[model samples]
Target: MERDLSCSWRARREAGGHAKGGKVTSSDVIMVPQIIPTDSVSVGRAATLALRCTMCHGARGMSEAYTPNLAGQNAEVVYKQLRDLQLGHRKSAIMGLHARNLSDQDMRGLAAYYSYLLRETPPSSLLGQRKAPRIIQVGSPMFNIAPCASCHGGSARKTASSTLEGEPENYIRAQLSAFKDGTRHNDINGQMRSVARQMTPEKVETLAKYYSQR
Candidate 1:
């Protein structure tokens, strides 16, 4: 299984060209619930605002590229990420540039608009508990690793956790690698980074593939 996983991970990396290298960012952004847009948010305004993002994030928030699908994601999560990008807490050249111009209201509107979209990308079970890979569903007790699903999946989903199911495999893998390598420290109090460090590269690839298939 390890051999197969290594081969597949290399193949995907070579073919995808999904992610580049990273640098460690010291995030001082606090973890607080965002004042997300309500149901009354103006979709037209949000659509107009998202026009600048279409080239990379797709016409409707779901990306055919290696980026994540924003449809059906938590509004709070979306707003927080935008805020982080704007504040220089997260490291993304393209995202930082686009986010720099957005006001608080603009971020909320975009968050609400994307969250309101019907989740049809991979048709994963967004409304209920779904089967997950063992590594995500249950962590390695001996390694003191926490399960990914505890905070980012199913009924126990945390307040600011981003949805992972149906994201691109390489995107997931790349982010996990960033966490493991100390190149992404935007996670609250290093929770994700700590868990990721305990996971082997093969395990990371397995987890990424499992979610991508959902």
Candidate 2:
């Protein structure tokens, strides 16, 4: 059955002018039919991926601590990260092995699946009442280290490139720490590293708490 399916796909490709060894033209790049199998095996694999992912990422991708909340993350970003883990660009003992077993289709499906999850909003009071040490205030005056909203706020804010409305605070802090310690120095633009280095331990905790509350 699999061989038959492969032959059929090949035939369709040839019909669309995609010859095995011939020079390809722009018109030959027609859309191929999506061939995801709706069998028990596929469903089981997807279910397993969801279950395994939930253990660390959270039931619906809303983690309580350090683990990144994958709910509502950009699908492309998630997909690329999975690919990076598989390629060794991203280092994770567990994630690298897990990503290795996943096909491109599986990665895309997982990305799409997690991206659709609804993000949980944190309490406003928690964000409003969080206090920080006085030194952070004087040290990082440029970015407003205490109040997370200072840099992560309105359209005109310093880091207004992306919205931090529903992201996981644990993930945010992890990235910041990674930047500071140089464990995750893959950021070519250097914006994240710069921000992370400027933040003290107190400031990281303060912002993490404040963002999590929001």
Candidate 3:
């Protein structure tokens, strides 16, 4: 089915009826142009777009290794990430190269395509049922040193920040590690670095495991 993306506004006539020389009573419906999806392209382009994403994000936009799971993500978020990669605001050696080659339309197409895939939640094992090191708990302090649920759960989760649900444990841990150290420093908001710096190796593992299990 086609989607209609538009904003609706309500209008009403003045109260007290139309005055002699003051006002007029009238109501009307106005149609504003909206950003709607048009089938101006072919399936071949879609297939190629998916293939381009699959080269790193996996065939289904779900990476098994250190890469993130992009399936079922918000289209805007995906588009922003692609733009960040291209602008050097996000650090990804491989992604940077790939994004640089894509046009704005290509990025949008990929984002829209991937946003429809099934979203995978982190494994339950990482949600904190298992025992973890004491240092991690002490150093991190919030969410038992686990950071996924904090920003990605409440109001913060709905924002531009990527959701942690259904992501691979290894990928989460790697990112945390990268943020903690100086290996990755392209966060436009600097939140990742701030959060990662407080985490030690033990904390990283505990949190990673916790998120994995969620």
lDDT, candidates in the order shown: 0.72, 0.57, 0.60
Instruction: List model 1 lDDT by residue over 132-214, tens digit each.
Output: 66778787888888788888887899877889877888889989888889777667767787888888888988888787777
Give per-residue lDDT, candidate 3, residue 57.
79
Please identify model 2 stretches exceeding 4 Å from their true place.
1-48, 123-171
Q: What TM-score against the true fold does each predicted structure earn?
A: 0.79, 0.60, 0.65
For residues 1-214, what per-residue lDDT tens digits would candidate 3 score against the true structure? 3444343222222254343564322222222224323353622365477886676678878877677788877665676677657755457788899888887667666666777778665455655566534442334455334435545664646445666655778988888887777576545345677778876677677767655565
> What lDDT tens digits, residue by residue, belong to model 2 across residues 36-143?
333456535665687888878888877666677777654544665676577554578998888999987787667656666787775667555755434323435665
Cα distance off (Å), candidate 2, residue 105: 1.7
Ranking by TM-score: 1, 3, 2
Task: Count clashing pairs, candidate 1.
Answer: 0
As for candidate 2, its clashing pairs are none
Best by TM-score: 1
Model 1 weakest lDDT span, ten residues long: 1-10
